[model samples]
Target: MAANVEDFKKRLDEQDLHIRESWVAAMKARIVRGELIKCQRGEGVNHYKHCRDLAEMYTGMIRENKVKGYKIIDTE
Candidate 1:
């Protein structure tokens, strides 16, 4: 029983890590696709907004994946 519990916990941790990596990958893809605008100005409010939007999208993706029982592991 203890071993099964440990395994479950490890799986959960791995899933969380996978989700985070997925978020990073999604954000990178969005940047590559020009969905996220480049900040010509310095690190201003627009830059912050862009980053926040990317993060929110990532979070949404994570939630969606979890609901589907899919682990989002990053290959790159």
Candidate 2:
């Protein structure tokens, strides 16, 4: 029983790490995309839209992972 518990804990830790990595990648993508629009003017509307889209995508991914029985640790 102890071994099984340890194995389960390890798997949960791995899944949490994977989720963290995915979040980092998503954040980097958002930053890179945002930087590409730095020289443009009158892009407030587009920028807001882009950010919203990325936010939605990131949230969707987290929700899907949760539905798959994975717990995302609140590292905040």
Candidate 3:
């Protein structure tokens, strides 16, 4: 039983890694699609970091399994 548990955990880790990579890819795509254009809340806002911030917000909500916690913060 212990062996089985370890195997399951390992598999889950692998799957989660894949999901994380996918989320990062999707976030990049979203940013490339003009999703980060003028994403500031007001004047004197960010210009370069907004893309990364928005991408992190988007990826935070994505999940590949129920064991993961999804925290989505509005960036735009």
Best by TM-score: 2
Which pairs clash in the backbone of model 1?
none
lDDT of 1 by residue, 1-76 (tens): 9999999999999888877866776666556335434442444666666566755665565454432234457799
What are the Cα lDDT values of the candidates?
A: 0.61, 0.62, 0.59
Worst 10 residues of 1 by lDDT: 32-41
**TM-score of candidate 3 versus the correct structure, residues matched by position:** 0.44
Instruction: List TM-scores for all candidates, in order.
Output: 0.43, 0.52, 0.44
User: 1 or 3: which has the higher lDDT?
Assistant: 1
lDDT of 3 by residue, 1-76 (tens): 9999999899889888877876776665566445545564432356556567765655564432223333447799
How well does candidate 1 score on lDDT at residue 29?
58
- Which runs in model 1 stand beyond 4 Å of their true positions? 35-76
Rank ordering of all candidates by lDDT, starting from the highest = 2, 1, 3
The collision pairs in model 3 are: none
lDDT of 1: 0.61
* Candidate 2 residue pairs in clash (backbone atoms < 3 Å): none
Count clashing residue pairs in model 1. Answer: 0
Q: lDDT tens digits, residues 17-72, model 2? A: 87787677666656644554562334676756556665555556555443232554
Indicate the TM-score of model 2.
0.52
